[model samples]
Target: MATTTFSKLVVFAALVFVGQAALITKPEGPTIRTRHGDVRGMYAEEGAIFLGLPFGNPPVGELRWKPPRAYNKSWAPEVRDGTVPGPACRQPGCGPNKIDYRHTCNRDKNRTQSEDCLYLNVFVPRSVLLNSSLRLPVICWFHGGHYMYGTGSAMVYDGRILANKTNTVVVTTNYRLGVFGYLVTGEGEDDARGNYGTLDQIETLKWVQQNIADFGGAKDKVTVFGQSAGSDSISVLLTTDKTTDLFHQAIMLSVPFSITHKTQLEAIRVGNDVAKSVNCSAGDMKCLRSKPADDLIVAQNEAGKYIANPFKPLELFMQWGPTVDGDILPRQTVDSFANGKIQKKPFIIGNVREEAVLYIYEAFSKPMSKLELDGIMLAFLHGKGPVALHEYNPPKASDYRPFLSHFATDWVFQCPTRNVIRNAVVNGENDVWLYVFDHVVSIKSIWHHKAYCQDHVCHGEDIPFVFQTPLLLNLSFTREEQVIADTMAYHYGNFAHTGDPNKASPNVYTTGNVLKSPLDWPRYNKRNLFPNMNFTTPQSVIVKDYNKEKCDFWDKENIYSARNKGK
Candidate 1:
């Protein structure tokens, strides 16, 4: 009897071990029904399964430059496995250092280029889909590389951590870039072609609406978030009617609605010039489309060299960006918001503390004078020179020029972000929360040594922290820094779950000034005074009296420029 009991006990132990292993192993792939046909995706990580599914037909041959069509054919005999990501859309070379110019001139190479690029990757936590009973929130992230470079496959944007931590489903997608995505093809049916990339994003969201439930996500609760140019795309999407009902909330990081096509006409002209250099007629769309891909890439490189700001050209004649085509974008985003046509949804918008400082620091090796500072202020503030000067005064000591660059930060990044908040508030959409990320990291070398004095929170510094991907920082974070990352992730996750970021489970560090919300970060209106939220060491809110005089001056100058067509 004792031997029999011992044998039974051993069997029970073996069964328990097997059950534990099963719990830890990745979940199985589930088939989801899409508009086109059914496709299956496999388990990606511990608590998530990612299906890199394609939604639209190949945009090639006669379909080139036209709106993407719905993919209708079913997969063949082999079971569909959305494990590997799709190729990026045909455009310029996204090399780590040099921008390849051969991408612009070659139609043959472009055709050979993978036409099956209209795909998106979805990440849904296994816990949320299989065990957890709750419907998870969905977040669709649009990658930013100036609308020129970047792909959805970048390691920094992996959604596994975000999904596991927030219990949310995350989706990131790839779309056409550069000329293929933004070229205006004249006033016929093609004039409607400027924003194919944006259209791709819209289609991806629609796909999620139809299929995300299989991954255990709430179709109605979707938020679109992007940084830099991606943020610009989010702003455009917010103002567009095509994306309405597709997403319920938006988070715009660093980019603003004021960034319009006027700032990018110069790049388009430069692209046109490059086409001409490659023996392609600027006026003949067919000729341009027929060129080899490598030649087009070379043309783009040549064009980049000719433009003054290769990174972000100041010339209007050589810019490349979303154009106000009557279809995708019926009107300018600024006009759309002012006219109240923009979708009325909750928004979370803010900028890093010292945005543009690193870019300027890298560009100019010299210190800026008071006059130069004021000039920049006037340019950005639209002539509100004195008001900005008063609020953001340079230190009396000449050595403080670096610190004084904060004026540039507030003018270019902070004020514009606030303007987005102001617009949302003016529309009576009070669901806007503003933040200023002042938590500076210790690694100054990554920022080219500018971190010594200015405490530069350069553009995009908040992304890794918010995503809890500190390892992407390329440097180790201190214990405190890790705490900051956790707090940031918690706050972001909270915002995703509920519209309010303050609703998250509070952490001890988060309760302190480090992660606390700014003081009185009130909604903007014509009547209410403009308030500034400071995300400093100890976060607090302060009602800032914007240098009214400088603001008025800039406003008047902008009005005059608009009347005179200086834009």
Candidate 2:
């Protein structure tokens, strides 16, 4: 009887052990199942990070100069490693002496460059991912390098800090640059149309729309934001009918609006120059496509050096970009916005205080004389030179770089931005806000080798503050600088969340990163005094009619009048 009782006790103990084992679940890593494959990411203090996820097929071989195709290869049974960043797209390497204030060229030194560079990175806060019901707003970023250089994987652009602070998902993507992306020969079976890079951007947006739900993101709440060349790309994308449903809001930072896109004839000329450099016929697309990417980069650089825009001489500086393709890009950005051809959405557009100082310092090694300034004005405006010179006359005639910088600022960035904003408002688009980043960068070495921008609020200066990268780099910001950085992030975060810069996110308190600014950002309108937020240290304030007279003059003269003549 005792042996039988012991046997029964052993059977009961075994059953209890089995039941307890079934109740305890095993801990899993930060693994996400995407449509392309199952990817294993790493967990940082703030969130789960997925790096180097390919959204499109490799654009190599016969796929060169073609629109991007969706990534279809699946790694279903096995998990793909996404811990390392992908290679940057093929571009010309810049030396240490070049104007790499953003340190993009140097960042490429650490990563490889290849034609298969259609990859993107994602950052999701830990709390959002763990909670099944939390779906955060998404901010898709595009980096700036004049459409010539830059990768989405640069260290300075890491989206972890921004994701953590804003409690949103942040995605940064890579697009082709220079000849590989924008060269147009008017040949080939596909016609070799330009704007392949912009197509890549659209492909990325499609990927986000399809896959972001798995990463705790709201597909309908996506906001596209960029700086400089990236911002210009957004302006072009705004006009395209293809991106109508991809994004709900936009924030263009320091768009170079005066640098008009190339016409079809001009693009063909540039393409011919490239082909000629490589010992091929102007119309022979097969030969151009078969050549090595490195060889093509050299040819594109050579072509850019000689192809000057007669209508706007300054446009030669940015010769290779979006072409006015009749279908995808209906017309120029300014014209499209003015005619209400763009998708109706809320947006924030702004420029820095000294947007042109960086370019001026790079162009001229020494200060300019009054004679040289007059010559520059004539070169810029042609028949209208004298009038422009009189209108933009400097108070201190001897030291004219400051005024020259201001004139270039108004012409290239500030004035044209205002014109677009006003046009958008008048055309029944009521939700638009304007701002000017008026604070100078406090960190001297962050300027890379170009120390000239240390004292001025130059182009690309607002980026670090927006990303709050100083904290990521173990560098410290001054008390005032920290406040400004927080304030910019706060406004941008709010804009991403609710499509209103002044409305704080309801979930902001959950992240314990609540941000506050004393000033209330006002929507831009003709009746509201055209208030523009001046972002600076200590506090940000609103100013009315910023550069009104200069903007009005440029709008009247219409530097891009050639676009209308052709239309």
Candidate 3:
């Protein structure tokens, strides 16, 4: 009897090994027929597969900076190992420094970067793709690193979590950054032209439309979502007529449409100044193009000191953002939205309660006084400081000035997000849902020096929660926090799958006195600004006005300041 049992066990073990081997090796070289050619990818894991395919011809040498052309059909079969990520676009800096100034201008970590970095990665659930009948929704992400740095290869943006949790196809692409992406030389030269980055994105969308179906995705059910500059790009795409058919829905995490023509030109002048300082002829595009990438990056960083908001200057070398090129952007995003020309689609847009706290934390060590706070209001509000003062009076105590940063929060981020919602409802285009993330982790000590007291939900803090990546990075979360992440991810996935977020059904989490129902969150009409949905402890919706009048006043004042340009 013992001998017989041992033989049976050995047979079972052999069967299990064979099944595992087959599962790992069976799905090898799955072919995908694209508009360009028949390319192949392979299975990466149990529920994930990746394809690193090129969507356009390499924009290098003579083709550099020109609008990306279609991939040539006559080209030979390039043996692509889709398992490896591609190089990022030629740009300055590395890692998070790609967005912030952690390195010197002389540093050229990205000198090895290639202009040929137009590759895109697709992450799909193997189960969905293997089942030919299942047509999953696709989420195409654009990474955010100030439009100058960041790549599809960044680990934080790995779509595995998104695909596994949401059961959808996820894609991330690399586009031109920095000088290669948005250097606008007033001359007719290709290098001087702006919006190259936007064009690269459009091309990737085109690729999705053509090849996504092969990966068991509905080409028509594409939802473009992004954060920070990526979110800014989504806003632009929604406004641009050229991208109307490329996507059906958009999720903008933190959109900022602060760029104007005057500001963009100033940025160009900064590039020219850098060129001249580096001994390259400012007038000669060829000479500037020939300069070493590192030297040019150093010059650009040196020139940043002369402009306010060096990363996003109003009218100088500091401005590095999308331009209203007549072909790609055609007009400012705000103007297009206000004119009711933007794509009519359901949108889910909101910001952290304390966004400016992050910026203030990075810039200053101390809090602002009531007088200094009034000055800031006046600067953004164009003499409407007194009205703002009446609405949002500073805390009486000087020690509580740190709390005043919330005023900056509402003025810059929260207010603008609410404005977008208001405009959408007022225009009668689509339904809009508003959320205020008030969940404050006990990590306040981590931000002690930034003066970010209270439960200041700073910018970009919601990303990890939304992606459900707390454990992957060894971050701790309570059972309740895990529930919030699950709920948020569920809603996001449902939104991408369908035009309406209500399809997710029964939003059981609420803050304040608000109840979690499929239709309880009313449209944000002016009459009822209370009952804003809060994501915090007890999860109840409550009727509390978040000083909307003060926020609106600041918005109008900023618009006026933008228009009048007082000397």
- 10 residues in a row with least lDDT, candidate 3: 99-108
lDDT of each: 0.60, 0.81, 0.62
Q: Each candidate's root-mean-square deviation in Å?
A: 7.8, 8.0, 7.3
Write one digit per residue (lDDT tens) for candidate 3, span 1-567. Answer: 111133433333344435664543242444455545545555444244454567778877666657877565633365445666666676665533443221111122432356788878888664454455567888898977667777775655667667756667889887787767776766465456777788899999988887788667788889898877788788878877788788888777766443343344564676677777788776567777677667766776676556633333333312466776665676666656656767888777767666666666555566656677666556545445566677776667664345555665675567766666667767876466667776765544334444454466776666656655445545566766765665566667767775665575232122333222333454456666633555555442433545577656755755422343331
Q: Give each model's clash number.
A: 33, 0, 12
lDDT of 2 by residue, 132-250 (tens): 35789999999898888888888778888788767889999999999988988884566678898999999999999999987889999999999988999999889998999999999
Best by TM-score: 2
Better of 2 and 3 by TM-score: 2
Q: Estimate each model's TM-score.
A: 0.77, 0.91, 0.81
lDDT of 2: 0.81
- Candidate 2, TM-score vs. the true structure? 0.91
**Cα lDDT for residue 315, model 1?**
25
Off by over 4 Å in 1: 1-46, 90-93, 96-115, 132-134, 190-192, 256-258, 263-271, 304-318, 365-407, 443-455, 471-476, 504-533, 536-567
